[model samples]
Target: MRLIIAGLFALAVMLSPAAYAVQPDEIMADPVKEARARDLSRELRCMVCQNQSIDDSEAPLARDLRLLVRERIAAGDSDSQVIDFLVARYGEFVLLKPRFERQTWLLWLLTPLALAGGGLALWMHGRRRPKSAPGEDGSEAILSAAEEARLQRLMAAEPPPESPS
Candidate 1:
């Protein structure tokens, strides 16, 4: 149906990953510089929109960051230089991907450390609990001497079970 086709088209548009928040006035005149600026925008996190990059955020802070990146690029700063400037202005938290320096080594190493800890815990748990033997019931009837004597007396008091052959 036409309605079904329209709905599918709308859903497809929504599901696509091509969303960008860059405005027309923000684009640089030079193509190469614009490309570099765009790439830098992708690398920088928008402070106002915590999880989104400046290139994909509509926040006023994101717009200012985009302009700032373009200005730095125009001023003949290299990608690394621009990034360093941003880092110096705002702490290392501004970068979407953090450098693996001494200060950030713990952040990089934590996942593997946690995984190893989990694996060790699983191994220790496995060692502590032995597997039950196949075809063997673990439960056993444990009776004390008094209990055994009482059981014997009760058995003697009961009539023999009639067997049907």
Candidate 2:
């Protein structure tokens, strides 16, 4: 009985994905167009899925995008031209590998600039931090033996209860 229940559970789980499945409307009129549609759909990101390509996604927008690709292919648009058209309609964010250009130059440069800026900030912070030893201005750390003991005790203090949980 347990084995039968387990088999039924596995089948249910496998078939659960068929609930919001792709429909017939997503197909192209011609098989040749359908092949192109499938290829293009794999390249095109699904706006709704945000990560999965249109071909892998079962979303309505993905289906529409698939149909749009089929229509474009049937109209005899070259692959590059079709991609360019979509890029023009949607921003470079749609393409998995965005074309590097004047418009997207800032996007390409921003991460490196941010990293350099952060490194600069960290360098500046380290420079500005008060030196602990008698190195920066030759002022020796004059923590008395008692004060050092007290500081050590404070540092070794146990953590309090984490009330947020």
Q: Which candidate wins on lDDT?
A: 1
**For model 2, which pairs clash?**
none
TM-score of 1: 0.70
Task: Give a tens-digit lDDT track for model 2, residues 1-165.
Answer: 999999999889667633333456767668877777677766788788788777777788877776777778888998887788888888676676667899888888999999999999999999999767654467666788999999889878967667885
lDDT agreement with native, every candidate: 0.90, 0.76
Model 2: residues with Cα > 4 Å off, grouped in runs: 1-36, 49-51, 90-93, 130-165
Report the backbone clash tally of model 1. 0
What is the C-alpha local distance difference test score of candidate 1? 0.90
lDDT per residue (tens digit) for residues 26-107 in model 1: 8899999999999999999999888888888888888899999999999999999999999999889999999999999999
Query: Which residue pairs clash within candidate 1?
Result: none
C-alpha lDDT (0 to 100) for residue 5 of candidate 1? 100
- Residue 149 displacement in candidate 2 (angstroms): 24
